[model samples]
Target: MVKSVSNITPFTLLDYPDKSACILWYAGCNMRCLYCYNPEIVFGKGKFTFSEMISFLETRRGLLDAVVFSGGECLIHKDIIEQIRLVKAMGFLVKVDTNGSKPDVLQSLIEQKLLDYVALDFKSTRESFLSITQTDLYDQFEQSVQLLFKTNIPFEIRTTYHSELLAKEEVKDMIDYLKFNEYTGTYYIQHFKNNVETIGKLPNSHTRLENHLPVNTAVKIVLR
Candidate 1:
């Protein structure tokens, strides 16, 4: 099957923790978060094929440390599990960036030892989930989060802070959901950068919602 990989960043030191890696940006996503900056990949088709990506990876074997599969929700692609396995076999650590909507794929990767790190987006609380994602994926998203909490795989849970879709109290609710569920991992409060096209109306320029986040406990918070 043809994979929906849209673009690739040959190298970056920031994407994966402490590793020199390349980014595989996939195409299309199941949810349409209003604050998302990657609308092109989320709504458009990919330009490259799975075989092409493999050919590219083949050339980076010794020079790179890891490969990051970010998307348009990388796990939405069915062929990702096999691709991860292939990359792992090629002697490179694999990191996947997902919105935590597919626990089955995430679990499969963990069980098969196909990934080294995971960056799951904790978009919103159940109350504001539908408004943010524009999908009935709240249950599925929660399942992925809980599954990650139980796994040994290293992960970073993040949220896009937008004043238009979420408030200070609601942001705390999202953080609380993680803490209540025994999640003690790092939770990043990502401030929405108005650099690209978003799904819905844009927030006002002064809407710095990240500054309003409530103090959270038990988990490490990295403000960006």
Candidate 2:
């Protein structure tokens, strides 16, 4: 069977930031983050081939402004570049949501000018990266960050904050790392949704994230 996207959200307004978009959820991942909400996508197989996705896009070309390629780490898929090319040919902008485990794939997309925007997940500080993501790819994540830094393309670095998995100090360390790298964009801290089923067992956070955010950093911090 040809590995392909697992699902599609036909339309969404909030995901692409000011543009109407649809989300393509790819299957499988290189990391197993404890708090990942999309365990089914991470563990399951693709449901839609590229041709099917393209046909779906063809029907929505005039209605949607962009396509958000998300996943189980969308970059891990081998056909992503070609898939993006097909989507782009349809006159839709492309956005990718990634965990930054595949810098080489990212670089290829960037070089080909296939991506219009990116939402990169900054999973954890280097020391705790393995514990949170269950993968030793912090260096690859860092390399992806650097690739974004060198480009003119717009992107956002965000972290899913679950107090039990990440401490206030660790969040600060991540912010400091971004600052030291001279990242001058907004760093979004999205609170983990308590009711959703996660990849691992977790307790609801009792602490307020607003109180835990670092004070007056060079990077603009936004709680979402």
Model 1 C-alpha lDDT per residue in residues 1-224, reported as the tens digit of each score:
56588899999999999999999999999999988888898998999998998899989989999999998988988788988888889999999999888988888888898878999988888888898899889888888888888888898998888777787888777777777877777888877777567887875534665456555477678888
Off by over 4 Å in 2: 1-3
- How much is 212 displaced in model 1, in angstroms? 3.8
Residue 7, candidate 1: Cα error in Å is: 0.6
Roughly what TM-score does model 1 have, to 2 decimal places? 0.93
Mind giving the per-residue lDDT tens digits that candidate 2 earns over 1-224? Answer: 57578999999998898999999999999899999999999999998888888889889978999999999988888878898988998999999999998999999999999999999999999988998999999999999999999999999999999888898899989999899988977799989989889998989966667877667778998898
Who wins the TM-score comparison?
Answer: 2
Show the colliding residue pairs in model 1.
none
TM, every model: 0.93, 0.96
Full-model lDDT for every candidate: 0.85, 0.91
- Indicate which candidate wins on lDDT: 2
The C-alpha stretches of model 1 lying farther than 4 A from their native spots are 1-3, 205-211, 214-216
Question: Cα miss at 98, model 1 (Å)?
Answer: 0.6
